[model samples]
Target: MPERVSRQLVYLVYGGKVEYHQEAKYSILSALHHAQGACPRILLYTDEPAQFIGWPVDVITLDDQILRAWTGPATYLHRRKAAAIRDALQYAEQSIFIDTDTFFLASPVKLFERLAKAPWLVDEIEGVWKEYEGDELHTVLAPYLAEQHGIDQRMLLINSGVLGFQGDASQLMDETLNLIDIMHPMVPKIHIIEQFAVSVAARHLGRPAESRGVIKHYFSGKNYWRHMVAAFFLRHGESFSAQAIEAVREVPTDKPRPVWWHRLNFRLRSVFLSSRMRSHAKLAYYATVLCADPYAKACGQGYAQELRRKAIPEGESLSIQPWSRVLTRQQKQRLAKLLGESATGHIP
Candidate 1:
């Protein structure tokens, strides 16, 4: 028999939506495919384990009861993310918690090495939330966080997507739970609670956790990547053959280089967007182009045909999967405008 994995694991949680579960599948595939050093055991906590059939991962069935307890009195669902860190404590002494949208661009072993220096590793998305403290929309966890934890430095507000715990996570988890139980009731925005909790717990434990971009956090490009990934998996299924990995590697991490015509057209039409809008407009534009990328389009089309052959019920479509929608011209324009409005500084 093959040797069993007893220590050092990777944990991920995917529940509720099929699209999210599907996304998790690709994320895990990317991790396993690119991992270097001693590949740790992968543990997926979800109600659906069969989704990852042949993929070399251990599935921990997460029933509704567990979710309810994880949510507890908190009405919002984000609490479950922090609760998940608590869950990891029971299984592995050292673990890397990966979010569905994240991919291991390099060996995650380096992450464990960093974790050895500290108890936690945080994802640096927007630098520190402290930078956005003046903006109420961005600083959702501040005042309440201050009330609960006595106003610690708000320098490292991180995305909860990539978390690494080197030692016993019980203490951090307990403090995090206490922080959530109090703050969730005090402040209504539970979305940032998980990442905020991780930041707070990390602060309480040790020094600042720096981010060197070990994992490619596709936080903004997920919508496009989803379509690209779905097509890859639809063609390959659970198998991680070398060709499949190589094919996925083609799914661009950055925006496709724009042709001179596209850039020239943007310059001429730059009047409508502000400085911030220009940056977001560019991102939105690129994301739109990538959403309908030729490879993804072909894969998506093939998957749809495959589904149609199986006979989807009336009123229901074979293309019911998430991230399946092609970006309409008008819709893409509106998203660019919206992103621009949300943007604070110049993007150049």
Candidate 2:
């Protein structure tokens, strides 16, 4: 049979952070491997070019204008994501934006297929009321809804973390950027930057958005708290109560699976085995050695370990250690020279 035509392209926005980047690469590779022929190409938008060398996907750099305006750590991430979407609009048939922190547990082609029936934004939680339970949450959104959007106080807030846009849709890019520009002054509350703006724009445009299958906000909820406690036990071992791990482990994975928890557990396992233990060795040694790689063959990439081995060269210095050990005085001087500043003036 002929290969299925790829109707959607996915992009992940990332900074140069080691852990997130490694996970991002793994996410993309895993997505591609599992969704083979289901997704055409996966693009990574990053400031660091060295990170994408051996990956099967394409890597694009953020333009200087976007980089300079990258006011907050991951706040810049959304801007880069919007820019990449606009860029991809020129070539792709359809597109979706996923955060670097996300992992694809199943083929997301159904998401793209849904867009053909209607142009919509993916809903995170059920509705606005569910998103805001009380005054505390309402206060955070008052400024955007009352002042900028002129909407009733009861509107639902949508998350922009995982979004799909139809390529043929008109002004989608323009409207998205305009919303971002409007939210620029609200930098202190940058955590809600993209979501608030996107929610407002969808309301204003009267555009309908859909939720991807069984989505869960991993960072929230009692179940997540339990999993976090379990991860802590896995990383901290006997230092953390074994009861917590057993409690979480016994919580019955047989229940309906949560979308985001699978990814979160995958990440916790990766860091627990890799670097989290190295930093707090005493707390983690027993646990790290005891736990199996939860994500070992979970990613669907038969060659995840092999790909990592090739991408990260043998003996390549890591940035996690102290500055002195990673770089020599002359090397620091050379870096300063390239940055066009004195070595002493630069902050480590």
Residue 160's C-alpha lDDT in candidate 1?
70
For residues 174-293, write the lDDT of model 1, one tens digit per residue: 888877776666557446766766677767555535445667777775555666666666777656455665565766555345567755765666555566545534443443343345
Q: Tell me the TM-score of model 1.
A: 0.72
Per candidate, the number of residue pairs that clash is 0, 5
lDDT of 2 by residue, 144-246 (tens): 6577658675565666667766545336665666767655554545556566656665664445456455232233332322333233334434221324223
Top-TM-score candidate index: 1
TM-score of 2: 0.55
Among all candidates shown, the one with the greatest lDDT: 1
Once superposed on the true structure, which residue ranges of model 1 sit more than 4 Å away at CA?
Answer: 1-9, 125-148, 208-211, 238-243, 265-348
Give the local distance difference test score of model 2.
0.47
Model 2 alpha-carbon drift over 4 Å, by segment: 1-6, 63-65, 69-77, 129-148, 167-170, 204-348
